[model samples]
Target: MCVSHSVSPDFCDKVMFLLAQEHRGPLRGGGGAGRTAQEGGGAGRTAQEGGGDGCIALEAGGDGCIALEAGGDGCIALEAGGDGCIALEADGDGCIALEACGDCCIALEAGGDGCIALEAGGDGCIALEAGGDGCIALEADGDGCIALQAGGDGCIALEAGGDGCIALEAGGDGCIALETGGE
Candidate 1:
């Protein structure tokens, strides 16, 4: 999605890269002009995203751009184009995003670390909980990332390298089903 701003008042002559892609500049592009963002003049600059409920709103400063942007009621959403549609975020902080319901929240970290915990509220859903040792984790403490459960082998008998996925944990006793992803 390359957009040129020859008519906009901003870029007089010097090329400037719009780090965040929400409304583009302080304003939205509506003049029938779009340019590839590859024209960003310089590199290694600081950028800030204005709004979004998630930890990552825009990935303009890093790799992978956004796939789609749905400014519904101002609550930035992804387009309904379905799968196979890849609107790359400027950065790749987290994957699979769901709206916060009741009190459920999912946190993600791109390079530093991943979610410290993913919890559901009230009696909503225990999608995450940090006290179990099943193949899949319902919760996680701030420990090994990219390196799954290296904290206390008592943690979850990890096979080293697995995502600490809640898959096996999601199903207990193989089929008895104590509670998917839960003990």
Candidate 2:
């Protein structure tokens, strides 16, 4: 099943077709002013958009669950589990937070002044964050974990455990701190 609010009919149809092909249950899309929330089940995917001063939240579960959000001066929070993947983009001054567990992957991009925080646990977890005049904090645990952060006039803090790897690249005035434990 597919549901869309404040979005074009063509977009709704395309989302339905894509969900059907993937055999994933349910797709919800919302746009326009105010806050929006999108949730999916059974390895599903969700996308949301919010106008000025509006926030968006997305959550999903099961293997291959994905969530994407875009907004302005509006924060975005996404949470998923079990091979979950999430991507977030924020315009203006807004923050993005993403958390996942078990083979998770997350990417966040912010325009203007904004911050990004990402946390993941278990095997093969990867996270990337990029923004301007914003801070990025990433933490991952277990094997094969990787975290990368890049920004200008921002600070990056990365922590990993057990066969973990972390990279940080900052342009202009910025600080980078990396920590790893156990191999």
Candidate 3:
């Protein structure tokens, strides 16, 4: 792997391990109440669960699959699942998420006050979203589709669907939108 800036030896080792286990097998985990689980698998198969305040979970599963989740106040999650798919989610105050699912799909979501999300689903699709005060979003669905959106005061959105379709929209003060569909 390459990076723009220098990294510590420990960071490099961790990154190497993560890359090396991309084609190993399957990994799964479950956390107890008010606990968090973090796991990494080989051959791209991983799953994890988290509960309680400020919890985080991360997993890489299946053929380049990954999954991650976080719960309670100030939570963050990241996951990559299925064939080259990834998913991330966070809930409660100050939440952020990033996810990719299905065949080369990515999805991200955050809920509650100050939330930000990015997601990609279906075959070759990309999506991003943000909610609550000062929100922004982007989403893409279907085969080769893309979308972006933002909700609440000062928002922007973009969406695309079907074969090579694109759409953009903004809500509240200062808004804009661009949309396209079909082949």
Which of the two candidates, 1 or 2, achieves a greater TM-score against the reference? 2
State, as a TM-score between 0 and 1, how close model 1 is to the true structure: 0.20
Please report the TM-score between candidate 3 and the true structure.
0.62
Best by lDDT: 3
Model 1 misses residue 16 by how many Å?
A: 26
Better of 2 and 3 by lDDT: 3
How well is each residue in 21-71 modelled by candidate 2, as lDDT tens digits?
Answer: 523423223554333445445434553433344444344454555554435
The global C-alpha lDDT for each of the candidates, from Candidate 1 onward, is: 0.26, 0.47, 0.59
For residue 34, model 3's alpha carbon misses the true position, in angstroms, by: 13
Query: Which 10 consecutive positions of candidate 3 have the poorest summed lDDT?
Result: 1-10
For every candidate in turn, the CA RMSD to the true structure comes to 17.2, 12.4, 7.9
What RMSD does model 1 have? 17.2
> Which lDDT tens digits does candidate 3 get at residues 1-183?
221121235744743464345224332235455443555456445556665554456555665555666666755566655655546666676665766665545456766656667666665555667667766577766666667777776677887767677777666777776777567
Q: What's the lDDT for residue 23 in model 3? A: 25
Report the CA-based lDDT of candidate 2 relative to the real structure. Answer: 0.47
Instruction: Return the TM-score for each candidate structure.
Output: 0.20, 0.42, 0.62
Clashing residue pairs in candidate 2 are none
